[model samples]
Target: MNSNTFSTLNRDLLLNQLEEETFDILVIGGGITGSGIALDAITRGLKVALVERYDFASGTSSRSGKLIHGGLKYLQNFDIPVVKETGRERDIVYKNARHLVYPIKMNFPIIKKESYNLVTLKAGLTLYDRLAGVKKEERHTIYGKKNTLENEPLFNSKLVQGSGVYVEYRTDDSRLTMEVAKTAAEKGATILNYAEMTDFLKDANNQVKGIVVKDHIDNKTITIRAKHIVNAAGPWVDKVREKDRPVTGKYMVLAKGIHIVFDYHSLPVNSSIYFQHKGRMIAVIPVGNRTYVGSTESLYTENMDNIMVNKSEVEYLLGCLHDMFPTLNLNIHDVISSWAGIRPLIGEDGKSPSELSRHDEIFESDTGLITIAGGKLTGYRKMAERILQYIEKKEKKAITPSKTDHIKLSGAQFNSAEDITSLTTLLHGRYIELNLAEEEIYQYVLRYGSNTEKLLQTISEYNAKDLNLEERNILAELAYTIDNEMVASLSDFYDRRTSYLLFDLDKVKRSLEIITSEMSTILRWDNKKREEENRAMQYLIKRTLSFKD
Candidate 1:
């Protein structure tokens, strides 16, 4: 078997490996944090295994703002440490996953009644640049009213004073998580999704020695032995910790944030803008043919398994959009798709959801289970390093230092962005006869990086003469993700594997029958299972579009 390829076809073998071998580390949760931990441990010469109840990045990791930003809003609360660390981490993430993590210039518009004046905004950005260790060429720049309006004519010029332009990285958060997990698997870490940890396996001293995992796909229980266990279960960290032992100290505060997507023609903007509205910071980002604006922060106490955007949240975002661009006349009906994510923040007394810190903290239960909770998406690697350091100190075992900062993630073999551009050009030239547009090829390059060549090969080798261009492309992507990315379900392909459900809903709607039929054939789904998968995808699409009353 090819070690680098993570495929659902090898599920039985992977599960058997998990049951038979005693690993040095067992990581719970397949989100970014857990994926990072597994990669870090495996590269350090320790045998590692990871298990996720659902598909990897099925939770917060898939529903983020899709940016590898430095938390610029945190600077308002004087969260200097958070700003500095996550800020500096942006570079490391960009360097490692250059294909997924990209530099985008964000404009912070200055308004007349806003709290930050031109001078103060410039000062804050200057400090932000210094804290982030920003490169000289990408440093912040102050733009006058004329230049600002020229840059983004959609802004409400009546209240605008000026703007501050700075560099922020955008990413496909789910894809990044998958690549990290795949890299871990390549390095000899046994990582499996759809495997739920049911109970802890403890010794006579009540110390966690292993875990009993329920395989959701095959409907079997397997006990995997490990020397160390890490609970990186994002919002479920506390719940997982309770299974090991009772929760004692700091706990997670579930903060729900939602984003609404609009067609580019409906809400056209030249640049990504981060602005303030009624004491809250909102970002309007344009990606591909769609523009997504988000995030209303509020305490969420509902079921963690089903988080949805409510009508009020939708109205709140629409209000912000109206305030920012009065000429656009955007409304709820203009929304094409939406997503909700829960932030597992460390709860603090007298702090609202918006006021909670994004910094991560590690907890060691008396039963010797290590749990990491609360962190920004940009700082996953550092969080992994810190947790590994804590483990080494507590266990008193020497291990190799972290090389992830220099170790490029899977498919990111390019030396620089220019190399990616060159590759895109080369691929488009080679595959021009396939009727794929140059722009489409560039997007494919961005999505799969060097793996685009493999995808192109799959497309070229496909012998479907009856399918249309779009259908062929979708089929090739589905086949590649299934055989290589461990895509076991329809939602896994549409949602996390690619963002067709969120950004390209029209494509999803048009190609649903084809995708479902193809996936059923490859995954060996019987009639009942095929119907279940189809129902799940339809419900997911409806849930994303339906607002809670």
Candidate 2:
């Protein structure tokens, strides 16, 4: 097996290795943060192991606004430090993972009855560019009402004043997390999904020692000893902390954010927009043939496991859309798919969810377990560095400084954007030769970077004579992910690996049977297990459309 091949076929051997080894760092939670910490530690020459209760990025990490941004909205709150740090970090993230994080132009429309006038908006954007260290060519540009309308004719003309066009990097959040985890595995870090930490192992002095994990796959308990344990669980940080001791100090403030998707023609826009409606900020972004508008933040006190978009949230987002683009008149039925996710923000008194700061805080418990919570997607690498620095201080020893900023994530080895463009052109010619659509070549490159060649090879070498080119292509993607990306279930492939369920539901529906059949053969699922997986995927499809009720 390839060093980077994190397949489920190796699950038993990996679990055995986990039980036998004494690691230097044992990370709980397999989200982006935890994956980053594992990668950082392993690169620094430390023995590391990571375990997740569910699939990797199955929680808040998969459900972000999907932007590697400098937090432009934080400027309104005068969070200059956050803006500066994340701004700098954005450049680093893009440099390291260019394939996953690429630049997108965002239009911030200045409207009547809003906080910023044309002059003030320009000033704010000017300050934003300076703080974020934006490159000269990609900095903000101001546009008057006429230009704004010409840029996005869908805006309501009566309320539009002007706009500021700037740059933000768009990404697939879950795929980013998986790549990080896979890179760590390639670097010799033992990472396992569907493995839950059930208890803590303590020494004679009650200092932290190791952990007791339950392998959900085989119903077996394993004891893994480590010198240190860190809790990087996003929403479940508090729950993991409680397994060791009481969760004191600042706790998590669960905030619910929901986004709705539509066909591109329904809410067409040439550029991504950040517009305000009735004192709330919303993001309208277009990815391929679908346009997704999101993210309403409110205090959440519901069942975390059963989080779904309700009719009221959909209506609220639709109202915002109708106010901004009055001509569209989009309603509930127009929504194609929707997703709801929880933000594990730090609790602050007398502040609304939207008003809360996103700065991450580290808490050291009496048992010596470290818990990290609250931060943005763009700052994950910095968060891991801070945790390592904390460990160095606690142990009073010299360790390696973080070199992750220079590490190109797996599949993102291209030296520059031009390299990716050249690769896309070359691959498109090959795909055309194979009777595949030329437009799809770019999307595959964006998702897999230079690793796309492996997918192309798979498509060419596949031995199915009965399948058409499209089916052969879909099955090749499934085979590649199953072999390299640790795809353990139907949902893992559809939801995280490819994002077909969210952005292209029609493709998902059309490819469901073929994908399920291929996965069943590869994973060797029994008939009962196959039925269970099919029903689970069906339930998810129903959930995305449940808001119509």
- For residues 487-543, could you state the per-residue lDDT of candidate 1 as single tens digits? 999989999989999998888999999988998888788899989999989999998
Report the number of the highest-TM-score candidate: 1
lDDT of each: 0.90, 0.89
Ten contiguous residues with the weakest lDDT in model 1 = 348-357
In terms of lDDT, the best-performing candidate is: 1
Q: Which regions of candidate 2 deviate over 4 angstroms?
A: 1-5, 348-357, 398-400, 428-433
Give per-candidate clash totals.
0, 0
TM-score of 1: 0.97
lDDT string for model 2 (1-549, tens) is 544448887888899889999999999999999999999999988999999988989998899889998878889989899999899999988988899998999999999999988999998999999999999999999999999999999999999999999999999999999999989998999999989999999999898899899997767999988988999999888888888887666789899999999999999988999998888889999998899999998888888877889899999999989988999989899999989999888875565656655689898888889889998889999899999989998889785579999999999988899988999889878666566665677788899988998888888777445788778888999998888788888889899999988988888899999999998898888898899999999999989989734
> How big is the positional error of residue 373 in model 1, measured in Å on the Cα after superposition?
0.3
Q: TM-scores of the models, in the given order? A: 0.97, 0.96
How displaced is residue 28 in candidate 1, in Å? 0.3
